[model samples]
Target: MKSVLLALCIVSVSFPALAINRYNVQAMSCASVQQAVKRDGAAILRWQSARNPSLPLYDRYVRNGLYCDPNEYAKRAYVPSQNRANCLVYKCADISDNLLFDD
Candidate 1:
């Protein structure tokens, strides 16, 4: 039992915890938000709703498709930033297999 517990501790300590970076879009310039995603590969961006100021909106943005899961693809998305209302960013989009080919 002691050996098992020691092995468990060693295994747990061997793997480091990974976390995604987050930023408030409203506090950053459009360029800054883009740069953050590019530098970090992915980030969680947050902003307030235009229609409902009290409501908060956020999503995970990626630098490219490499950051997305195999079933998801990177797509263009816009978010409000300090300098631009439609700051360009990439979001992971779901890939639907329902589309039929004409062939």
Candidate 2:
């Protein structure tokens, strides 16, 4: 019974960690991107520059859509230490998507 209780406690502790909400930001610009990062704790910046006159600028991009692909932005932009990832998908946001985990 004691062993079972210990196992249950361990499972309960780890369950929250596994349930973190991982979001992929799609087409975020430079400014609002910062705001999203600050608010959500973590975000993926999907960059899409406008070629035509009808399209919106960088500012509008952040406000309208979500970006995905941190590695792409980190290569060009200045991502902080916590955001920089050695792997393909860089952790661009200093905060974690997981509400439980404090930035």
Candidate 3:
């Protein structure tokens, strides 16, 4: 019983807190955007159907986002405020469509 309790405590202490985050799409590329359907697994993004008439073709794309739980160490380890930024995606950068997460 004592051994088990020690094991549990050590295991918990070693790992960072994993959050069930609703993934946010930081951004997507124009080319990849063609075949893509979602910003993140849970959210969508602006796409070709709504292409802006005035703006020149994009050489790069950018976007933002949300949420997490962290211990003091993790909270400090990350520079961006928790739950305030979305993971970044790139277009025709040949990124895979089935990426599990942006990060």
- Highest TM-score: give the candidate number: 1
Write model 3 residue lDDT over 27-57, tens digit each, in one string: 4333344223234321233322125535332
lDDT of 1 by residue, 1-103 (tens): 9999999999887763246798999999999999999999999999999999999999999999899889987888999999998999999878673245411
Between candidates 1 and 3, the TM-score winner: 1
Look at candidate 2 and give me any clashing residue pairs: 25-66, 25-67, 25-68, 26-66, 26-67, 27-66, 27-67, 46-67, 83-91
Leading candidate by lDDT: 1
Off-target runs (Cα >4 Å) in candidate 1 are 1-18, 97-103
Candidate ordering by lDDT (highest first): 1, 2, 3
CA lDDT of every candidate: 0.88, 0.38, 0.31
Off by over 4 Å in 2: 28-103
Off by over 4 Å in 3: 14-16, 20-22, 27-103
Residue-level lDDT for 42 in candidate 2: 40
lDDT of 2 by residue, 68-92 (tens): 3443222223322223321122243
RMSD of each: 4.9, 13.8, 15.6
